[model samples]
Target: MPYVSMSALLAFVLVYGLGLGPIPFFIASEMFEVAPRPAGMAWGSLANWGGNFLVGMGFPTMRNVIGPYSFLLFSAFTMGLFLFTKFYFPETRGKTPTQVAQLCSRGLRSRPLTTATAKHIL
Candidate 1:
């Protein structure tokens, strides 16, 4: 790859770190009830760090073994996560924990929230 291409690719981490790095933490915080939130956040942070460590420690070897295909592996995983979130993850903004849990349990099949449903749930 050319210098500009390499630089552009490497620059993504800066953008991600600045713009999107806190989103998972925010989501995890919002997802749990008050009684369990501390523990939940701890576990979630641990998992996040574990996954980061895996990528940081394994990426070089993975790249060596799979060459350019390693990026495809990441891309596929990201796309899968996107689809999973799109389908099953509930909107938690202004919602109580019970509502969020109900939404999650109902899975991807839950219909769009109407004002009546929202009012009733609240």
Candidate 2:
């Protein structure tokens, strides 16, 4: 197989293999406490579909504007977003539902975790 095809295949495998299923699970698990159960699930599903639709529908335009590496550019942006969220977003694992909601409403500064402090916890 050609290098491009192999690279593409590898990218697909890496994305779907590791990323496809885990993100929603992680987000849902975390957000469930911050939002009501029903709202959390609804928002999670909406965000998932919205993001997928936006990326799929915008691909052609993105490609045209950004050229052949549009997917790579998107991936980079996504990675940055994920990292930013991971570092800045609070970990709600053991917190009560009310506490989580309060944290969300008030942002990280009002709670225990912030980007600067996340490194210590994680």
Q: Which has the greatest lDDT?
A: 1
Tens digits of per-residue lDDT for model 2, 1-122: 69999999789868775876456656665655643676777777788778778877988898899898787986788788776676667778788767766666776543446676776656
Worst 10 residues of 2 by lDDT: 26-35
lDDT by residue (tens digit), candidate 1, 1-122: 69989899679878767754556677678777778778878887777788779989999999999998898998898778765665457778888887776665665573576798667656
Give stretches of model 1 more than 4 Å off.
1-10, 101-122
Estimated TM-score for each candidate: 0.67, 0.61
In order, the Cα lDDT scores of the candidates are 0.75, 0.71
Which residue pairs overlap in candidate 2's backbone?
Answer: none
lDDT score at residue 13, model 2, on the 0-100 scale: 64
Clash-forming residue pairs, model 1: none
Best by TM-score: 1
Model 1 residue 122 CA deviation in Å: 32
